[model samples]
Target: MHPSFTRRHLLSASSAGFGMLALQGLFGAQSPLVTRRTHFPSKAKRVIFLFMQGGPSQVDTFDFKPALTKQHGKPVAKDSPTVFYQSPWAFKPRGQSGMLVSDLLPNIARHADDLCVINSMHTDHNAHPQAILQMNTGSFAFTRPSVGAWCVYGLGTENQNLPGFITINPEFSGGGPLKHGNAFLPAACGGTPIGHGGGGSATAPEKPLKGIELPFMKNARLKTEEQRRQLDLVQTLNRQKLAADGSNEALEGLITSAELAFNMQREMPDVMDVTKENAATQEMYGIGDGKPTDQIGRACLMARRFCEAGVRFVQVNHSFWDDHSDIFKGHPQHALETDQPVGALLTDLKQRGLLEDTLVLWGGEFGRPPLLNKNNGRDHNNVGFTMWMAGGGVKPGIRYGSTDETGARAEQDKVHLHDLHATMLHLLGLNHEQLTYRYAGRDFRLTDVYGEVKHGLIA
Candidate 1:
């Protein structure tokens, strides 16, 4: 190789031009992960979003419809092929609040009083891909920053050593990386995915996140000091390039991300190691070898650790709840896989005093319809679904909205996807409308031009 020909030049000329572009911005005055001020005083300082990929049936889970039970297996109207199917699980009052919870999620039922169930969550799309995209990014037609990305962009993070946003066991399909992607937002704001995407089934009995490690985290050829010196040399070149180019947002973002990645090598190992927890703690999350709850248990426990370590946003994905053909078999399996870990997460957080200021959200992209198809399962329903929130600043032990008698539509106090996003931002002391980013000559926000904060959900 020629003495003048550098590795950077080789990378630039090769198919790895994109990788070189990411390295161009390797130095900045201040890290983007530095904590910043909020728009207002708020109790919630962080968020843990439990994404149930594919839609879960509201009627079978939290929303109990006695009318549907009474009129089960009946057609909607004269000559209608579709018939109303009642939930197989029985619903009974749980906790002091007497919130009706199904037998499918008996573990979560224990915390009914601490839950603020929203039975009227409706989204834009009925399809899985679009609905999932809309739920995560607030738009299905166009790509945009995810809710986690937006949170990091708005408030930065409390831990400069870690990435602001993290997603555990994220799905690759239904919008893929774009679900947790930064989009037009700064690259530093994108989520740092822990495990490989498109994991196994919920009941697969394998710990998917076990033994996961960040790629390119270690250098076999160089000592720590040697690597630092090499980084310093590259940073000098990056600074020179920035000086020549003046101001570039993309370049700046790359620089910030590169530095954060380097710092993460030191802190992430300890944070990701759930084994460090006591046996009792691990048992609480239902973590064990060959257990059905082990996969989601690891994800949820890691979410708490990430948040406790000051990560601005953490998402735990439990794919999938799309039970179209076998509702009795599929829904119960999914619930069994997640219910214990989810409930334990809330209990653990409260016990550790983290729940007071940590926001926890649970739901899916959309929900299954009340009416069953010929296959004896429900189809996708974007008209009305259910979601729940706990801790944070939400009013616990209350049901905010409701669907019709048949649980077909949101009859009152409907909370659209945009409104949910707005309320989440509001809880974190961010005004959704005010959190804007200028890209392609127009100002854009997570909520686009629509969203009203559901103050009723707030304490």
Candidate 2:
């Protein structure tokens, strides 16, 4: 047998495997804090996404359809597939711009001039899991890095002591962590979740982030200085192993995670602590007001603090909007729970001067159909919906695009989910096409192979 064919020799000869490992290690070591330049001059410095988990009926909320109301309880034709159900709420022009807004969101309606309502927004899917996935990651059929992950990967983090991206009170269903996951990107780019927004309970249970406090320190077993010294030793040993192994992504992640945890222990607690705010500030968010607004208010307030601290992307999730029955009851409850907090977030951001550079996005996965479906409620409608954006370089007080006269489909200036993703990246100064990640021998992006920036939405 050739000497090189010996078991020991053959094992040593597998240098290509080692090379691949080393290459992975090199990529893994890429820091999430290394800021990169945008493709062009951009308007927004960061983004805050107020994600309404289930679909909210646009016709009942922002898109008022007089034609539909006129035809209420009437069939489109003798053979029409669905029955027409007009919205229960009243629509009135708000602000100086005379933007018509439904009374369902009175608090939000107060800031009509700050909103850029896109009534012709549509997506690829009609279901929650796929539609939500498509809305967050821009792909419903495949696992992909989320928009937040892409943002972190492209722009890097401003604060090394804190996570670049955060999702507050995210629910476990409808794509769950996948909606905030990094996928093929570096693990560090994934969002740090504050609390799981429970399964649309009347009150979402509050849980602190796991590992937010070091067990040893929490138990008083190790002092801060002592832990630092121990961490240094552990990191040193990991580095030595990395040198011997030629490269190890897991080891690199371990080292990075350890360092981040230590720093977070030192700094993150204060940022997460909403009690630090004054009574008036807390009251403004309805923190102790004993209403549905309290839960989302806390979340919105925390989001503001995170944004002020330079977090790149912060998503505050409000859920259970999938009202297939009792939308009259469901929509009102959701609006009451979210409207005040959302409106407060915008008002606070503007007051703190963060509004101009902080892009705020508010919408659900899709929207409800114009016609009634099961038990006097609307069905999932991906053909046309409504979404709104504020600040972040978008033209304010403008209503772009339109659904049909019956508010059933996008008939003018349709903005697909891909287009929304592209426009979001554009606002953040990233070219959706140019923001590419090499994975599985192919270059992938948030927008996949299709995206066009909605130029008219820009200021």
Candidate 3:
């Protein structure tokens, strides 16, 4: 109806549009996760990030320092400012691999052979907000796209209906949304956080995702034909906008998101309903059970379901590891809540044969120091920490890197935060240097200008 419109133009446009319709139908049926090709053959098809909030003490958890234990309550030298602290829990070898694990986490120790512990991990910041931001976004100095956002941008999602990246019970404190935000990336690549566990716990009943239920339409028994007509009207306006500006990537992503949300109404409810699982299975995740284990278990169980459904990235958070006082009491409770569920998640994934292509990563933003404070607790230390990985084409039953005699800093095979990002991207078949998004007249990447994939970790 514009002044330039003509009968001949309309006919010609219609012909091309009809052909485009056929192509759209074919592509639309496929997952956006598979929309792009990997730079190389990928070892991992998906990623599950288990975020342990509040820095967990390395010496008290996985990093066993025999010298520190022997020199408990002693200083490095006469009049030394920092006093040494030892773990109350005993460390013993577990599994056939003889991986050292603390008695504090007996359940996780059971599967020691599957873990690839990295003890020499170092980050830039020591503060909670900065460290948490760096761990999630690869930067603390500026807002940047989160690792989950990067994964979805590079890999897309296997499930066309569900969101590509989901963060269950993401904590609200510290860096909060900045830890999961997409920054300059397309908004659709950002993580969808379900439930609020940000206050340091996931014990509350999970609030269903906004706009998930269409109660009004459901009660009215809305017909498919009627829904299609309504959607067509919306698409008509969107198409006009797209036609006006072909460079509108944001609008393009919005159109795709709207379509995905519509399709999700048909499938998500079923996938979220863990009640359909057998009683034995429910018990495994400790859903109906009491205390801290109950909520974290549900979160872990939900992660498995999402992974099976082809979600590219699923983040399950367990929090309040910041034990500045009474670590003896605080850390044990945190471990009790997380250990059973984490062990169960690993076992279930392996049994289902999903572990081979699904990478499971576990760690906190940083780690606690070996120096005990007046409150009988360790303070934050960014120089050296510990993290572990399982499955996803990594060699199992191995410990890579090491901390100093007192577990104060990385003594050998040091891996910086950027290196960690690079390795994870490599596992997913993305070249860190090449996987970039241009914004503000400059190219940006998850690892910025620095990163080297630790090929030694890969199988």
Candidate 4:
């Protein structure tokens, strides 16, 4: 028989594997979920992102365009027969700031003094999948780490027992898991999804979170102590295999996920149960068994609980704002479902003194166009939109940027998706340029190689 090659020879045959093992050994001793210091001191310790999946009409929601209304039914251009459509909802000044907000979101309008609205937001794509991908991952052409993943990677979690990032009721389409995925980052940094948002129309009734369970969480056969013992034995064997393999990113990820799952089984059930909250609190969020606001109310309330418990990022997804047709019927219904809960969430966070340090982001993939289709609905417009940020060091009650008179494109102080990511990182005390992960022979960041932090938005 031929002599077997030594371990050194095996390593020499795979230098990349040897290097990976060395890198893992240098950083793997501590749990990746443990809290880490930020690049600088920042007021925001957590984030609660309210994602209005699909495009929400900026002209109908926050961006008041009297020009579009005045020119209603008139040709969009000198020669084109296509005409502009006015927003059906009325716009009125709200709160101390006198910011104009559409009546469709009256509850949110009441908190205008607390909001910093950015009207000239644009992205690269008009399509749902690409636009949503760019909004979440910063790239439409390539797979990349999500904004939530980057936040968790940079700051980790204050609560070691829970996931660093959590996403509630994520949609199954329009980029799906990639919207919250942790590509090229540590597996622990990815958003832990709770319930699923069935990909349906905006008017579809949202399902309640009554018996949602973490996949494979409950063990019917084993007692708690027995389960622990079994886990320990399995982990020990996994470690042995890891040692023998020298380097296996997949195996390492599996080990970390398993440990987190075990820890989550001990604490997540209690955290997810919103019924424990008092009646007044529940009523404040508009939470009821079969109400329009019930789904989002529960989501927003759960977001607060998660943030209060020290999760680094929590995303609450409300879906089907893609009003391509019958927008008159769709937008109002969608608003009814989310408006009160979102307003309540902000109020609740403020009352608990959490909003000051917890950043709240609200918007969607893009905005609807000013021109109306034959179906009386607006088409997708990637040119201009509105998104709002409150608390967490942002200047309150301010309106920044603007679209053109027709609202066809961003006209002034336009903020691109990359700039948004940069600003978000900056608010979290992370230098966007410095927060990079070395992968595929290059350093990858949430904003890619492009981004300029908009300091004016910061308080």
Runs off by more than 4 Å, candidate 2: 1-30, 76-82, 196-219, 244-247
* TM accuracy, model 2: 0.89
Inter-residue clash pairs, candidate 3: 33-156, 33-157, 171-198, 172-198
User: How high a TM-score does candidate 4 get?
Assistant: 0.91
Root-mean-square deviation of Cα positions for candidate 2 versus the true structure, in angstroms: 6.6
Window of ten residues with lowest summed lDDT in model 2: 1-10
Candidate 1: TM-score?
0.91
lDDT of 1 by residue, 1-459 (tens): 211222234234333443434444322433456666777887799999999888889998888888887788888887887888888888999999999999999889999999999999998899988988999999999999999998888888999889999998775336799899999877888998877321244544333544655568887898778878887888767756655564456666766776787788888888888888899988988887667778788788888888889999999887778877878888988997889999999999999999989999999999988888877778899999999999999999999999999788898999999999999999998888878776776778899999999999999
| Clash pairs detected, candidate 4 | none
Error of 4 at 389 (Å): 0.7
For every model shown, what is its TM-score relative to the native structure?
0.91, 0.89, 0.88, 0.91
- On lDDT, the candidate that comes out on top is 4
TM-score of 3: 0.88
Ranked candidates, highest TM-score first: 4, 1, 2, 3
- Candidate 2 residue-wise lDDT, 49-98, digit = tens: 99998888999999999999777887656866558988989999999999
Tens-place lDDT per residue, model 4, 108-147, is 9999999989999999999999998999999999989899
What ranking of all candidate models by lDDT puts the best one first?
4, 1, 2, 3
